[model samples]
Target: MSIADPVAVREHLLAAAAAGHPLTYSELLARLGHPFTRPRMRALCKTLAAVDDAAQADGEPELAVLVVRQSDGLPGQGWWTGSWEKHRFTGDWTGPDARLLIDRLQRQAFRYWQERAPG
Candidate 1:
């Protein structure tokens, strides 16, 4: 699959959600048959935003919240400061507050997508 394919990425993220777990960028890329690189992650982030948009349109939680950093278990800066502004977190984008919010959002995603999604 292409690196920027939002559908492919959403499937992986939903699988993680079904497991009630989060995935690191490297892990996600590997699942997609690619290696980790900043440029690739950047492109992936865009697709993630689009995926989130669709989810929001469908009244679902942001699935991208499950795609987190390996070090912090939190979404990358792109998510925190992305263009999707309805429920955007405007704080430091890190630390306790951000963690709490991200955690809540991720749990919501997990709860919504953890239905053993068909494919």
Candidate 2:
């Protein structure tokens, strides 16, 4: 679960992706000379998204991504119960791949709980 060599995996994935090759879960792990469960791959997807600043930037470093209810202007501004509440995960959610994330990073219990709490 612990990604002792995340740098290597990241580099390999980037290289493979840049080479016009789409890496499957198994392919990615194989390239890393390791075997991981499917959940680990999902967690890696989140991890990659979080760690890669380029993926999060929108030409402005000052503005952080915000998630608002699609059905309403914002939360708690009014009695708006929106059907679509949007929030950026930002590598906080444990998701269904919780086990993998926990294995990689140990101090995720509180974060995972907060993500599951009623908003």
Candidate 3:
């Protein structure tokens, strides 16, 4: 299976959630044992959306939001443009407002996944 498949991406997302922090795209690439590349990032983003779709259906916080840009430590263009009703942010995808929104979602994902993880 491709590393960018939802199941593989989710394993890394679960790790980030358990660690209580966001994971950079590059960092997630490393975890998946691949070097970073735009094509890879793009592929990952597609799978991430799928993961989030499933999460939304299950009433789970989005795990994809925990995958961020290494530069800003926040999600990229795709996430910024996606539809999110639970925790919407109308501000630009930077600055305090965006950070706050991302942080809140990441924290929610962390709590949800950590609680569900088998000890």
The digit string of per-residue lDDT tens for model 3 on 1-119 reads 46557888888898889878888988888888888899988888888999989888988888988989989898999888875555566788888999888888888998988898888
lDDT of 1 at 55: 88
Clashes of 2: 0
The TM-score that candidate 3 achieves is 0.90
lDDT of 1 at 38: 98
TM-score-wise, the better of 2 and 3 is: 3
TM-score of each: 0.90, 0.36, 0.90
What count of clashes does model 3 give? 0
The Cα RMSD of model 2 versus the native structure comes to 16.9
Off by over 4 Å in 2: 1-6, 54-119
Alpha carbon lDDT of residue 39, candidate 1? 96
Put down candidate 2 lDDT per residue, 32-64, tens digits, no spaces: 565757565555544444433442353211110
